[model samples]
Target: MASVHWAIQPVLALFVASSVLLTGAVERSPPSFVVDLDKPAYERWNSVIDANPDLGRDAPEIFKILTGNINMSNDTWGILFLMAEKIHKRLPAPFKEELQGMADRAKMPISLITLINLAYDLTAHCTSVVSTDANGTIWHGRNLDYNATTYLEKYTVHVDFKRGGKVAYSGVTFAGFAGMLTAIKPHAFTFSSNERDVGSFLENLLEMMDPNSKFLMVLIREVLEEAKNFREAISKFSLARMPAAIYVILGGLSNNEGVVLTRNRTHVIHEFAINMQSDRWYVLQTNHDPWLGDPWYDNRREAGETAMNRTGRNNITVDSLYDVLSVPKTRNKYTVYSTVMSASHPEAIRTWIRNSTELIPPPPVRASASNVVGRFGTFAAVLIVLSRNL
Candidate 1:
C-alpha cells in the first residue's frame, strides 16, 4: 500500500515483538462515515456515501459472507427476519431511521441491514485490556475478532457519533454496521463488548425477540452518550438487562478506575479491577469468563495477560500498549482491528485497521484435480498447501 497507510505496524512490531515476525503495515484506518444525531435519523448515514464510497457496492457481498456460516435458504431466512421483527420492535428511534437511510442508500433490505448490525453481538470473539502505568495513567485497548475479517478489515473505519455538532463518542467499526462494539466517551471512559457465549445464538435470538431486550452494542452507545464517568457507567451498565451475557471493560480518567464487569441479564455478578495494592495493575478479558480462565483452545486471555505483564508498568505508553496487544498469538488472523484509547488523554484516540500478512486469511484456492479445498488462513497452513501445490 501507500506510505500513508503504513503508520505503526513496523514500529509496533519492532518495539513490542522481540521474537515474533511481522510484515506489511497496519493502516491507520480512515473514518467511514460520521453520524449526526441532531439530524433526522434517516439522514445520519448520509456521509457514508462520500466518506466510505464502496459501501454501496459491497453491502450485499458483505452480508452474504457474514451469513455464509448459517445454514438456511434465502426464503427461510427472510421469513425468520420478518417473524423476529413482528415479535420485537427493535429499531428504536434513531437506529431504525438510520438503518432506513442506509438501506435506501445501499439498496438492500432493512431487515438484513438490521440483522448484520445485531450480528456483531452474536459473534463476539475479542480481547480487551485495561491497565494503569506507573504514573497511574489508564489505557484501554482491545482487539476485535470475527470470521469475516477478510471483508471487515478492508472497509474498517472509525465512526464519530456527533451530537449538537460535536463528537459525542466514537468507535472503530465496519462500513454497514450501525451499532457500537467498541467506543470512547471523550474524557469520561473507554469501553468495549466481549462476547460471552455461555448460551447459544438461538438463546440470544429469542432474547432479541422479547421486545424489551436491548443489544449490548446499543447499550454501549447509550452508555457512551449518557454516562460521564467510570462509576456512573458501571452502575448503569451493571443494572442493564442486556439481551445476552457479556463482559464490558471500562477504563476511566482517574487512577485505579479500570474494572471489568462480569454480567448476566440483570445484574453484574462480579467486578474485576486494577489492584495497585496487590500490583495487579491490569485486567484482561477474552471470550470466556475471566475467573474460570480461557479454554485451552482460545489462549487469548492467557497470551494477552502475559504480554501485559511483560510490558512493565514503568515502560507502558500508547506505543508500548499497542506492542503488548500486537503479539501474534493475541492478535491472530481473525482480528479485524486494534483500538487504543485513554479517557484521560482523549485527543489521542488511536485505531489501526489490522492488515498485516499474518492477520490476512489465505486467498481462495483454485480447483484442483486432487483436491477441492476452500481456505487455509493460517500462515503455516498456507505455506504447507503452497509447497504441496508447487
Candidate 2:
C-alpha cells in the first residue's frame, strides 16, 4: 500500500481545523492516487486491474476499511454464497452478463465481487438532503461518512452504466459492488442510502443472509435501472423486505419530489416527504435514526438543517450546496466525499473529494489525453472489481 505523510504546522492549526470543519475534510492535495474507473463494462475493466495490481495485495486491508472489525471468517463466505445464490436469480439479465464480463476481464473470482457488493452497506453512515433551488431545480446531496483511512481515499471510483433502453445512471463509489450509495439516473430519479443503526449490528448482519432478504444496494440498482418514476421507486421499496435497516432517499426529476423511506428487515417504519413548496423546501438527515433517538449521534443533523435553512432553498446553487455540505458542524472524522446533484437534470452531478493536504482544494489536476485514458482504465477496473469482485 502507498502512504503520504502530513506535517502539522502550529500556526496553521486554525486553518487546518477550519478546513476540516468547513469542508468535512482538511486538504485538497493528494499524492499519486490510482486512476478513477469510468467505462462501458465490456471494454474498460481488464486494463484497470492490469494497471493497479496492488489492489490484489490490498484487498483484505481494503475490506477492513469498509467493513470495520467484522471478522471475514469462512462462515462469512458461506453466508455470502447462499445470499448470492438467492439474489442472483433476481438481478436483471443485462446486468448479470455485464457483471460476469467484469469478473472475466479482471481475472478475479465472481464471488469476490458478490461479497463486496453484499457487504458495502454493512458498516457505513451518511447524510442526504433534498431541496429545490429558486429556479425549482430539484437538488439531492449526499455525504458518505465511511470508516476513515488513507488507503480508502485513493481507491474511490466513478461508474456510468447505460443499458440500451433503460435510463442511464452514474456516480462515485468503491469498486467491487453493484449497489449504490449515491447515484443519479437522469430523467428518471436520483437516489442515496444513509446507514441507520437500529439493533444489534452483528445480529442484523447475520439476518441479511436469509434467502428471503433483498440487499439494499442490489435493490437500489434494480430500481435505478428499471423504475420509470419516483413513485415506482418507492413502490419497489414498499414491495420488498429490505435486508437491513437504512434510509433510502429517492428524488424523482419528473415529479420534482423526494421521499426518505426508513426501513428495517420487514417493512417501512416511517417515511418523510421532501416537497418543494414555496415556504418549506428542504430535507435533511444524518446518522441518527429519528425513530430511535441517539443523543450521542453527532449534532450535525441539527447543524445541517440549520445550514440549509440559513442558505434557504431559493438561494441554493451547486456551489452553495457544497458549502452547506462542507460545514464542519455537519461533518466528522470519517466523513469522506460529498456529492450534490440536480436530480431532475440528468448529468448535473458534482462531487467534492478529500485529499491528503490540510488546505483542501479541487481534485488534483484536469484530465489530459493520457489522464483521460487512465481515467477510463481506472473506471473499468473499479467497475470490474465492483461488479465482478474476484
Candidate 3:
C-alpha cells in the first residue's frame, strides 16, 4: 500500500506538472512536426513516434472504453482487436500505413492502434464556426470535443505535410491518427470536420465497410494537400464520397470564403455561406444540419450562436472568437482543444489544448463515454498499469 501510494503521488504530480508546462499550449503550440509526403505513409510518423514514445501506450484502456457495438459486453481486448482486424481491411491506405508505422515504432500492437484510430469514426462530435468580421476578414474557430478528452489531449500534434521541401498543408491532429480533423493550408483555406450520426449504427458500419467511400477526415487531408484554394477544396469536398455522413465548416482566405456543408455518404446536401450584404456573416455548426434544430439536451448550437451574435461581426477577433467558443456548451468538459485560424492570416492559425469542461449537459450514449466519468476512469486505469510495472 505504501509503495502504491508512492507510485500514484508522482504520477499525479507528473500529470499536474505537464498541464502547467503546457499552459496556453495553443499559443506556443503543441510539438509541431513536418511530415514528408514522399515517404510511405507508415514511415512518415516514425519520428513522431520516436519523439513521443507514449504513442499507442494508452490504446489498451482506450480500446476497453471503446467497446464498439460488437463488443460492449466483452471485457476481453483480444476479441476487440480481432474485430478491428476486419475493420482494418476497410480503412484507407494512408491510415493503414501510418498506423502500421506508429505501432512498430511505439512497440505497440498494430491491431490496437487500428482500433484507436477507428474510435473517432465510430463516435465523434464537435462545434465549429466561420465568421466574416465587419472588416470582411474571415475567421474560423472550432472546439473539438470527444469522449477521451483527457488522454487524447496528451497526444495532440500539429503537423505540416510537405513535399519537395515545401509545406503543402497542415493539421492539428492527434499523434497516432493520420487524418486531419482540424487543418489549414496557409494562404489558401482552413476547415474542420464533424461526425454525423443520423442513422442506425449498423447502417454506419456498412458505410465504413464500403470500398467506394472515403473517411471524411482523410479526404480533408487530401484536399488540403492537393486543392490549391477555397474554390477547389469546395468542389472536391462536395463531390467526394464518404463511408458515413459528416459536417464540414470551411474558412477561405477571402471575406466571402466562409461556408458550412452538410454531407451524406456520397455528397453534400446543403451549403450555408457568409452573406455580408445580407447581414448573415457568420455560421455556427454543432453536429447538426443547419435546417434542423439540435437534439434535446444539446445546447451547443444555441449557446454558440448566442455568443457569436453577442460578440457581433464588428468584433470577431481571435480572442473574441475564443470567448465565443468558451461560452458554456460550446466549450465543454469533453473538448480536447480549441482552434482559431484564418487562411488569410496563415501565421495566426493557432490551436490550444483545452482543459476546461464546464457546463456539459447530459451527453447521449457514445463511443466516448462522457468525459465527466471517463476522465477518472482513464486516470485510474493508467495508475493501475503504472503500479503493476513499478
Q: Candidate 3 lDDT, tens digit per residue, 1-390?
A: 001122323433333344435443232357899899999887899877877776556766655544332224233354445555666665667777787788888888777777677666656689999998877788999989877666677778889889999878888887777677888888889988887867643356446655677766567777986889989989999998877788878899767788998888888899999877788889889888888878888989998898777667876777677667766578776888888888888777777777643233334445434533555354345434433332
Model 2 deviation from native, Cα RMSD in Å:
11.5
Each candidate: RMSD to true structure? 9.0, 11.5, 10.9
TM-score of each: 0.84, 0.73, 0.80
Ranking by TM-score: 1, 3, 2
Instruction: Name the candidate that leads on lDDT.
Output: 3
- Local distance difference test values of all predictions, in order: 0.71, 0.62, 0.72
Better of 1 and 2 by TM-score: 1
Residue lDDT tens for model 2, 264-333:
7788888877654545577677767665544764777776776777667666676666666766655555
Model 2 C-alpha lDDT versus the unseen true structure? 0.62
Tell me the spans in candidate 1 whose CA falls farther than 4 Å from its real position.
1-26, 53-68, 84-89, 356-390
